[model samples]
Target chain A: MKMTPKAVVIGSLLVLAAVVFVAVILPYADTNQTVPSEIFRSRVSEEAAGRLIYIQNGCVYCHSQSIRKVDWGLGADRIAQAGDYVEDHPILLGSARTGPDLSQAGGEHPDDWHIAHFINPRYTRPVSIMPAFEFLGMDRVATLTSYVQSLGLKAADRRMERQRFWKQEAIKAYEAGPEANVRWLNENVPQGWRDVPNPYPTTEAGLARGHVIYQNFCLGCHGPVGDGMGPAQPWIYPPPLNFTILKGREVSGGVLYYQIMNGITGTAMPYFKRELESQKIWEVGDYVAVYFINQSDANSEPRGIDAAWEP
Target chain B: MSNPSPTYQTAKGFCLTSAFWMIVGTLMGLIGATELVAPDLTKNIGWLVFGRVRPIHINIVLFGFVTPGLLAAAFYYFPRLLKTELYSERLGVVTVVAWNIALVAVVLTLMLGYTQGREYAELIWPIDVAVIVVFLMVFFNFIMTVKQRTEPVLYVSVWYALAAVILTACTYALGNIVWRPSSGALVGIPDAIILWFYGHNVFGLLLTPLSAGVTYYVIPRSVRAPLYSHTLSLLGFWSLIVVYTHIGTHHLLQVPVPTWLKVIAIVDSVAMVIPVMAFLINIWYTAKGRLGEIHADIGAKFVFTGTIMYFFVSIQGSMMSLPDVQRVTHFNNWVVAHAHIGVLGFAGMIALGGLYYILPKVTGRPLYSRLLADIQYWLVLIVSIGFTVVLTIAGLIQGNGWLNGETVYRILPQIHPYYVTRASLGLILVIGAALGFYNIVRTLFVRSGEAVT
Candidate 1:
């Protein structure tokens, strides 16, 4: 084969054009024909503005929006669909999961929690490597927050609706003072969970483990002394329950356990069911009872047979 | 021949450009790595945020360090092979200047949080145009040089270089969606499909082909041997364009893309072995019995080692493209490891090799210090392998943990140690870049003395 300049140049470009037609153009035609998924809706002006901010900050580098079937175990509620992103100018299905997938991140938390997180993710998640967006100022952060809170589209709106309704109830309880707030919170727990004692006894080792969990997961909002005056207090309203107020209120081990595991949805508290296991939750509940409220029914009353591993 | 001695200004300029920017590029990478280790390390410093720093590191390494280094060698090799001077050194110099200005603009714009936000396609619309224009400028310079050649037959290296420049010019424009300036992307799934296609081409058409061209030139010339097989060379060139271009869809396989597209990507990704092996066999066979000759030349030594890394990276790439393999590899540091091996170990090594090979030839002097070049070589080699090992382990921990139902946050502590190791390794790489900069600048400017940084 004579390696002429024309042969090399013309032949290679022709090959490239043909491949582009097959690999690129053909796929574009096929995938572009997708209809909107059920939850899909056009972005409003606020969401559009926030989406631009998301793009500008390169947030897609760390966070992903694409949820897969395998993510169901990791608390995924919905699998991503092509049509869900119909209006996105550049669909930001990121490559890495340096952070969690955000396919349904909208309404996962209240606006105030998002604000504190924007100021510093460590304010909510102790070990989060996400950078602070405080430099964006409150306005831009709020804008970015709006975009984040709209991640699940219509499903997100439905979640946000529930959040708004519960938020008003939570605020009303909070303003009625600590006594009423504690009663209301305690009553919300199921009858079965309300009566279930913290099955695990409080040991020094258990207290240590609970302390570590508290700092990592709770101190951001609840403060080191459980006073709820943490750094994120200014942003999160109905302010992370003043744990000091639960004393003499007959708040059982089950109430602590349930709140920690299920979280008060309307306020800033997030459910840790996906993050913490059962034993850890029990241990943490005992830790709080002994230290913060200065009371514990752990290993008391209706005491059944001890577990094989209980020390 | 009264033309101021044909200073090879174009090649020398690119040599300096590549050497200088390697420091900046590697520094950005080090910064990003440090943030991963200690996210608060640069807290609230908007310009230094990890997200912004990451794109700076990637784009600079691609357009700044590797591309210019490979081009330096191509500019030197083109005239020699064609038996004529460059078509216009003046245009070449303008292109280099514009390239540096554009890189500066890239850093500024991205730092200011003005980006289009697609990986490998993050550059704003204007910078995208700058990239395509310069590539076309480079193509014009090379193709014109080819036309006026006293030599009639084009070497395989020339084919790779010409095809690379022209193909990348077209691919860059298409991939970047230069036609859509405001957003620089299509809508929805099509946008994602196009972005990955363009992202992969950033490597396939640009870095891979340029690295192959340098390997073809440096390996045989170092051993004073003719290419072991011309047929293998042709096969490699054509197969690369066809096969590599089809596999960008592999990056989109896990997404909600059409199943047919994923199949094409998977099948073609595995088929990538043909082009990779063809190029390797030809180069390795040429250097087979002549390891001693290649070893004696520091330049050839670097290029040859890159070929070995290329073999590993391509094989790993093919395996990871498998759907089952991708289930474990996608959206994790496993892909990060693959990138480090490909960019740093394979193409980056070849780029530096070409830089070393051409520096003395273009400058008409021996390198300031071969020892520094050797040190830099080991530094990059260690960074490459070290990154692969550490990041891959981190990726496995992440992938398995995710599959096992642990949330991404719960696994943070598990990967912290690896991120720390990666950052430390990054420091060593940054030092190597500084050393390269000192050596290159001194060699180009300081006519005498050892490189005293």
Candidate 2:
């Protein structure tokens, strides 16, 4: 093939045409062919507006919208179907997970929790490296929260329902009195969990590590002094748990671990299972028992797992 | 002879402009990297926010730095290889001025947050239109020069340059959705498919071919040898056009894009090996035994290293398209590493090489300081290698951590040091960009040497 301008232009155009056909034209033609999945639905105007805000703020740089089958090990609730993104313009299936996958973020926390976290991630997560979005203003923050809470579409609605039901009960208990609220919070724990003592013994190093973990994961709402009056307290209703209320109470390591692991529904508490490891949860729980609650049961008999580091 | 009407002035203008922008562009990148390490580093500064800075870095690097540098060489060679004066030096200078103005507009508008919010296509419609006009102007000048060519047969370099301009003009217009002018996008998933098609092709069609063209021209001349295989070079060119076009969808494989589109992307991504190898083999064979001579010329040294980086990135790109590999590689710093290798290592290196090769010819002067150029080269090489190592390691940690159900914040502590390292290396690259600008400026306007007639 002698190099000629005509040949080069023609060949380049042909290749472009082929790509446009295969990648763009055909896929666009079949776009309407995608049926909405069970969990897929159109976004309301507010969510759609919030989606624009999310895009503007470049949230997609940190969070991914699509979850895959390979993500099953990551505790993904559902594999993303193409239909799930049918209504998304420029579908923000982000290219980095600098933050957790937000595909199922709806009802992950109350709107108040989201508001406080957005104002400053460090308030909710002391170790968080996510940029503070407080500059988006309170109204824009609320709009962004709406978009985030609607991530899972129809499935997100069900989770939001559970959060709403729990929220009303929690508020009622909180309004009654600290004694009634503590009882209500403890009653949610199973009998087996309430009776189980901390298996790990308390040490200076352990308590120090626990303190760090508490600051990163719990201090936002639980307060620096464990009084449930941290910066986020203003926003979160049924506020964070005051560890002092657990003093002279029948609180055990298992009870604290369960609540931290699963998070309290209808409240601002978020599940720590995704963020903290087994040892971290136990350590933070022990730190709470020893410091704010002025009690310690971590040295009790039948310690759960033998500490390999302990002599 | 009355100074020949400053025949290469347009090329000189673009060369200086490109070098100047490389410094600004790399500094933007450094700031973005610093903010990644400390998100509060630029809190409440909308103009300097990571989101805004990121696009600025990308746009400036693509248009301001790499493209103009390559075009600098193109403007020089188009007249020389065609055995004619440029169609109009006046028109060429006008285009260069317009190009810089458009770049300025790109920066100001993006900083002001008037973006369309699409990755790679973020420029608002007005700047988009300005970009198209500049490309059109270049196409007009070049095509007219080609029409007036005293030489009958067009070289491969001419074809590549012409195609890059005309094709990108069309691609930019279509990709930016110039018709709508408001959203700059189609309504849904279809828009993603088109945007990435344009996105990947911006590199595949524009930078790849331009760099290849400059390499094709510089290597043989620097080594003072004939091309190893003109036939092979043309084959690589055509095959690149065909295969590279369809691989954009590979970025969307995990998403819910059509299955057939994904398959085509993967298949074509692997097929990219053919053209990539063809170009490398031809170039290496041409420089086969003349490596000492190539090293004697600083320009060919950068060009040759770029070719080697091209081989590594191309192979890595093909493998990354696989579903299993992507499970661990996608949505992580691994891809970021890949981008650095492709853009800075491969294309940016060649752009610099192209500028260096043409500088003496255009200015009739040896470089102001060869030592500084050499230092800049090493700095770029070392920093790019450091970036690939640190970012790839961070990516693997993040990918494997996510696979193991570890939380994103938990992985942050593990990768924090790497982020610090990346920012530190970024400082080195910014210094290199500054050194390159200083070297080019002095070589062009300051230094005096024997005049070429």
Q: What is the TM-score of chain B alone in each candidate?
A: 0.98, 0.97
Pairs of residues at least 3 apart in sequence or in different chains that clash in candidate 1: none
Candidate 1 local lDDT, A59-150, one digit each (tens): 99999989987884332878888888898888899999999998899998999999999999999888889999899999999999999889
True contacts kept of each: 0.83, 0.55
After TM-score superposition, what is the CA distance of residue A102 in candidate 2 from its true location, in Å?
1.8
- Residue B124 CA error for candidate 1 (Å)? 1.5
CA shift of A69, model 2, Å: 1.3
The TM-score leader among the candidates is 1
- Residue-level lDDT for A14 in candidate 2: 72
Predictions: Cα RMSD each: 1.6, 2.5
lDDT of 2 by residue, B1-453 (tens): 224644598899889888999998999999989988998888877778777888899999999999999999999889888888888889889998999999999889888777787888989899999999999999899989898888988988898998888888888998899997988888667878888889998998899999998998999989988889888888798888888988989988988788888999999999999999989999999999999988988888888999999999999999999998998898899999998998899999999999988997887778887888899989989987888899999999988887787777788888999999999999999999999998888787773544322
Categorize the docking of model 1: medium
lDDT string for model 2 (A1-311, tens) is 77677777766777777767777888889875678899988899899889888877667777888887777423287888877877777677777887778898998888888988888787777777777788888999999999988989998888899999999999999999988888888899998888888778899999999998887788888888999888888877877888898887778888889999989889988887867888999999999999999898896966666768674
How much is the TM-score of the A chain of model 1? 0.97
